[model samples]
Target: MGTIEYTGNHHAFRDKLRRYLDEAVAPHGEAWEQAGIVPLSAWKEMGEKGYLCTWVPQAYGGRGLDFLYSVIIMEEMAHIGESGFMVSLHSDVVVPYLFTYGSEEIRNQFLPGCVSGDIVAAVAMTEPDAGSDLASMVSTFREEEDCFVLEGSKTFISNGINCGVVIVAARDSLEEEPYNAISLFVVEAGTPGFEKGGKLQKMGLRSQDTAELFFNNCRIPKANLLGQRGSGFIMLMEKLQQERLVCAVSALAGAETLVEQTTKKARECIYGSGMPLIKAQEVRFALVEMTAHLKMARAFVNDLVNQHAAGANVVVETSMAKFLTTDFLNDFSRRSMDLLGEAALDDDDVFAKALRDGRVMPIFAGTNEIMKEIAARFMGL
Candidate 1:
C-alpha cells in the first residue's frame, strides 16, 4: 500500500481518538444497535473532543484540520466497528455543502453548532422514486415573498431523526428543466411544516437512523437558499468527489477490519484433525487472497485521498474506488462468514453485522452500477 506521511500531530490525534473510542464508543455499539440509533451524548462527546468536523475553519469552532484528519476519524470508527455514529457523513460529506455554499450569515448560524455536534447535519437528496437519478426528484419548492415553501418528501435519508439541520434539494416549482430546476436549501429540523418520519427498520446499520422527511409547506427564509438558485445539481455533483472518496475509505477500512478479525478467528478455531483452521491450505490461501486485495485497494484509496487533498479533480477515480472497495468489502465479509461456518452466525458475532452492513455499501453513495456509469461517461465511453 502507498504510504501517507503522518506528522507527529496527526499520529497524536489518531492516538487520542483511538483511546476515546475504546473508552466511550466501542462499549455502546450493541446498545446503540438495539436502540436503533446512536445517542446524542455520543455525538456531543466526540465534538467536544474536536473529533467532529475537523476541517471546518477555526472561526467556525473547528480545528481547521486537513482532509487527512477526517480520513483518520473514518478509519478509526471503522476499526472499532462503529457505523451508527456516522461522523464521516456529517463531517466530510454533508457539512461541506454548508461550508462551501452557505452565505456568511448561514455559515455563522449553523457551522459552529455542526462543529460542536450541537447540530447534526444531513443532506436530503433521494426521494422515493429518485435515488441515483437526481433529475427525477419530485420535491418542489416555491418562492413566497420572503420565504421559500417546500412541499414533498425524501426517503432513505441518513441522520434523518437526529439531524438538527438538513441540506435539502428540491425543484423550483416553475422551472421546466429537471436539471436546472433543482435548488438546495438549508432547513432547520423544527421548521413548521417539516417533519421527520420514524426510523426505518433495516437489515444493517441498525443504529444509524434512516427515515423519511416530509416538507408540507415547509418554509425557510429566502436567505437559506444554498449557492445560486437552480444550481443544486451542480453543487451536488461538485461535492460527490469527496463523498465517494469517503465511502471508499470507509469500505476499505471495514474490509481490513473484517479480514483481521477473521484471520484471528481462523487461528483460534481447531480442525477435526486438531490443527488450527489456519493450517488448512484453503483457509490460508483465502486469507492471503483477501489480504492481497485489501492491500491494492488501500493503495488506490490512499493515492486518491492524496490527490483529493491536493485539490485535484478525482471524481472519476473516486467513483471507481467507491464501487471497487465496497464490492470487495461485501465479498470479503461473505467469504469470512462462509469460512467460519456456524460460529459466524452467533448473535454476538461481529461478522454478521459486518456482512449485513457491507451489503449496503455497494448500494449507497450511488450504486456500483451508477459508479461504473459515471466512470464510463468520464472515460468517453
Candidate 2:
C-alpha cells in the first residue's frame, strides 16, 4: 500500500462547530443563564443560520444534513460548556415527533418555525409522581366533539419557560390502560387555561429553565392531536432510543471536556508546585486508568452513532453507553475534584462547577439503574 491514511470528518465538523460556538453560543451563555432561558431571538438566529435543526428536510427549511452534523453540534456545545441549554434535545429529541407523527397541517403549521427557531418546542411527559414509569401519570384528556379538554400538570419540563409550543402527553380515560390510553397534543403558549408555574431550582444545570405546567381544561382543536389517537406509548418507546443516544453523545462530550480540562489543571499545578500532580504515582495511575476508560467509552458511543446512522437500531448499545459513561463521569468527576483539593470547591473555578454539573449526568435522561435494567434485558436476563 503506497499510502494508508486515517482522515475522518469529525475534525472538520469540530472546526465548523467551533466557529458557531464562539460566534453564537459562548458570548451569550452567561446572559441566558441569568435570564433562566435562552432568548427567542437567539433560537431564530440559529435557525436562520441552518444550525437549529440541521437534519430536518429542506422543504421544512432545514438542510437535511447527516446525523453526524447534529452530533458535532452536540459535541461543540458540550466542549464549550453549555449542556444545560439543551440544543440537542430540542433538535433531536423533541422535533422528531412532529416530523414523524404529525399530520400535514400540523407539520405545515409547526415545522417551518421549528426549523427557524421562531417556535421553541418541548416535550411534556414527566409528571410530579411519574417519571420513568409513565404508567403512573395522572394527567388526563377528555375528548369534546371538535377538540380535547386537557387537564393535567407536568413537572420538570425542560425549556418550560421558553417554549412557545409543547407536545403534551395525557391519559385518554380512567378505564383505559395507562400506556395505551396516552395521547400527545400540541399546546401553544398563552392558552387561556394553560399556565406556567414557578421555576424549580436544581442542584446544577441552573441555566436550563425547568418548570411546572398546569393544564386545566385547556381546550385545543382535534387538529392539534399528534399521530394516531392511541399511539403515544408506541411513539415514545420508538423515540426513546434516539433520546438516549443524544444523552450518550452529550455525556461522552462532557466526559472528554472534563478529562481535558482536568489534565490542564494537573499540568498547571505541576508548573506551580515544581512537580505536576502526575508526579504522584497515585494521580498518575488514576489518569492512566481514566484515560483508558474514557477512550473505550468514546469508541463505543461513536460506534453506536454510526450504527444508528447506518439504519441499525441502537437501543441496547445506547443504553450501555448511557449507563457506563454517565456513571463513570459521575465518579470520575468527583475524583478529579479531589485531586484539585481546595480549588475544586471554589465556585469561581471550572473544576468545581464541572464536579457539580457531572453529578446530574447519572440521574437525568433515565437513571443509570434504568440503563442497567435495559441492558440486562438484552442479555435475556
Candidate 3:
C-alpha cells in the first residue's frame, strides 16, 4: 500500500522479491513481533535464497548482482512495514563496510557466513553520552601483549540482542582527539566480557531489539581491528552514505505505506458520508501533493544509489534524502492519522503501527537535525 510498491525499475527482480515476501517473511512477522526477535532460521532462509546480500559479489556467496537487487530488498521491507527487522541494515549498510574496508582476512573470515546468514552482524557507534556526537564518545581501547582491551558501552544499538558478530568502536588512548582516536574491532557473540543488556522498550520499533551493549575489559585479537588505527571516524563517515540512502528508501517506502493505509481507513470512515477521501477536494489535493513529494524523493534516491554504485561520494545527497524523506514520512503519518480520526487510535490496526513507526523515522540514522547540518554544509551554507 506504500508509494507505488514497485516502480517497475526491475520487473523480474521485483517479482522474485514479491514472491519471497509473500511466501517467507509476511507469515512470520507477527510471530517475530511477539517473540521480540526474529528466528535465526529466517536469516538463513533469506541467505540460502541469495536474498541476504543480493548485491554482494559471488566471492562472498552472493548472487554478484547489481545494487538494484539491494534496492529490491529495501523496497520489499517497506511493503511489509517490517521496520523492526534488520535485514536491510545487515545486508546493505554493515556488510558493505566489511566488503569495502575490512582486511581481506577479516572479509574471508566473516563475509561468506554473513552472506549465507550463518552470522548476523551489528555496528556499535552511539554511546550513552555521545549520540550523534562521536567527539564526546569515551569508549577506550589499549594494546596488550597480544590483544586489545576494549572498555565501553553502546546504547540504542540495532540488533543488539541477536547479533552474532559486532563491530565495536573504541577510542584509542594514545590519540589526542577523541573522534579521530576511535577504532573499530570485531567481537564475536560469546566473548567473555561482552554482554547485552535488556532490550530497550521504545515508543516505536519496539520489536527491533534496540539495547545496550557492554564491553568491560573485553579482549579480542589484534587481527580483529577493522581498519587502520584511528580510522573508525573516517570509516563511519565513508560508509554512512549507503546507510543514509537505505534510510531514505525505507522512509519513503514507509510513508507511502502510511498514506495507502490511511487512505483506506479514510474510505472506511466516509462510508456513511459516501465519499472516498480521493473524491474530496481537500483530501485529494493533499494526496496529490504528498505523492509528488514522495515520487521526487524516490527518484532522487534511485539516482543516488546509482551514483553510489559508481563510487561517487553521496554524503550530501544521502543527508538530503534521509532528512527530507523522514520529515515527509512523519508529516504523512500525522496527517493520515488525523484523517482517520478515532479509527486510527485502534490498538489492533495498521494505523496505530504506522503512527508509531513513522514517529521514529526522523530520529534514527542520525536525527533530522544532524541531517540538516550535513545538508547545510553541502549547500555551502
Candidate 4:
C-alpha cells in the first residue's frame, strides 16, 4: 500500500512532468552541477508547462492547482537526482510569502513574474553568525524619509545567484526589542547597494547557486515590507511548518531512490562464479532494513502532509518528521555508498550525490537539533 492516494489526474500529471524532466532537465544535471548553476531556460520551460507554482491562484497566471501537484513535482525532482531547479523552494517557500502577505501592489508586481518564470525568487534568512536562531541576526533595515535602508549581509542563501528577487529579513531597529524588531522586505536583484556575492562552492547540490548576499545601505520603498512591521518572525514561524514538511518529503524521496538503485545493482552484480551480491546474507539484510525503515517514514510523512493540507497545526510532528527523515537519509545514503564499493566514486554516482545533498537536509529548514527542541518543548518533557 502507498502513502498518498494519488488520483488518476495526479498520476497523469506526474507522468507528464516526469517526461518533461527527462528531456529538458535531467540530461543536463552533470553539466549544471559542474557549472554551479541551472539556467533560467529550465525554469521558463517549467512555468510554460504549468509545472511551477501549482498552488498559486489562477489570477496570478498560475493553474490554481492544489498543493498535491507541487508535491508530485518535488518528488519527481528527487527521482531525477537534480536538486538545482529548486522549484519547490520557489513555488512553495518564497512565492507563498507574496501570495499570503504581500500587499495588492506587491502581489500584482511580483507574483505574475514569479508564475511566468520571468523572475526567480529566494528567501534570505541564514547569516554568517546566525542561523536557526532568528533573534541573534544583526542585519538592519532603517526607515528613511521615503524608503528603508538595508544594511548587513546574508550567507548560504539557496538560489542566490539565480534569484531575481529575494525576501530579506533584517533588524527593523538596532536597539530595544531585538526579537520584535525583525522584518521581511522584498529586495529585487540588482537593486543598487544590494549585491549577490560569487557562488559558494558546496559539497553537493552544486547547481543550486548557493551564495552570499550583501546589502550595503540598500534602499527600497516601505511598501516592500511583507506583512506588518515586527511581524516577520511570526510570519516565518507560521510558514516553517510547510518548509520543514517539504524537507521531509524530499528527503524520503531521495532515500527511497538511492535504496532502490542500490538494491537493483546488488541483485545483478556478480562477485565470482556468477555469485550475486544480493545472495550474500549481509547484503540482503541491509536492503531489507532500508526498505523497512523507509516504509514507516513514508507513512508518517504522508499523514503529516494530509494534516498540513487540511490546515491542521502539526508543527511539532512535522519538526520530528524533518529531523527523523533527514537523519535517516544521511545514514542510509552513507551506508548505501559503502555497500556500492568503489563504484560509488564513479563520475555518474547518484548515490554519492545523494549522500552529499542529504548532508544539508538537517541543517537547512532549521537543524535537527532545533527540530528536537521544538518537538520536546511542545511535549512538555
Question: Each prediction's Cα lDDT score?
Answer: 0.93, 0.82, 0.82, 0.90
Question: Which of the numbered candidates is closest to the native, going by highest TM-score?
Answer: 1
lDDT of 3 by residue, 215-252 (tens): 99998999999889898999998888888888888888
Q: Rank candidates, lDDT, best first.
A: 1, 4, 2, 3
Compare candidates 2 and 4 on lDDT and give the better one. 4
Clashing pairs in 2: 270-276
- The model with the greatest lDDT is 1
- Residue 270, candidate 3: Cα error in Å is 3.4
What lDDT is obtained when candidate 4 is compared to the true structure? 0.90
Off by over 4 Å in 4: none
Error of 4 at 111 (Å): 0.8
RMSD of 2: 2.9
TM-score to native of every candidate shown = 0.99, 0.94, 0.94, 0.98
**Candidate with more favorable, higher lDDT: 1 or 2:** 1
In the range 1-381, model 1's lDDT, one tens digit per residue, is 267888999999999999999999999999999999998888888899999999999998889999899999999999999887799999999999999999999999999999998999999999999999998999999998889999999999999999999999999889999999999999998899999999999999989999999999898999999999999999999999999899999999999999999999998998789998889888889999999999988889999988999999988999999999999999999999889887789856899989877788998878999999999998999
Could you tell which candidate, 1 or 4, scores higher by lDDT? Answer: 1
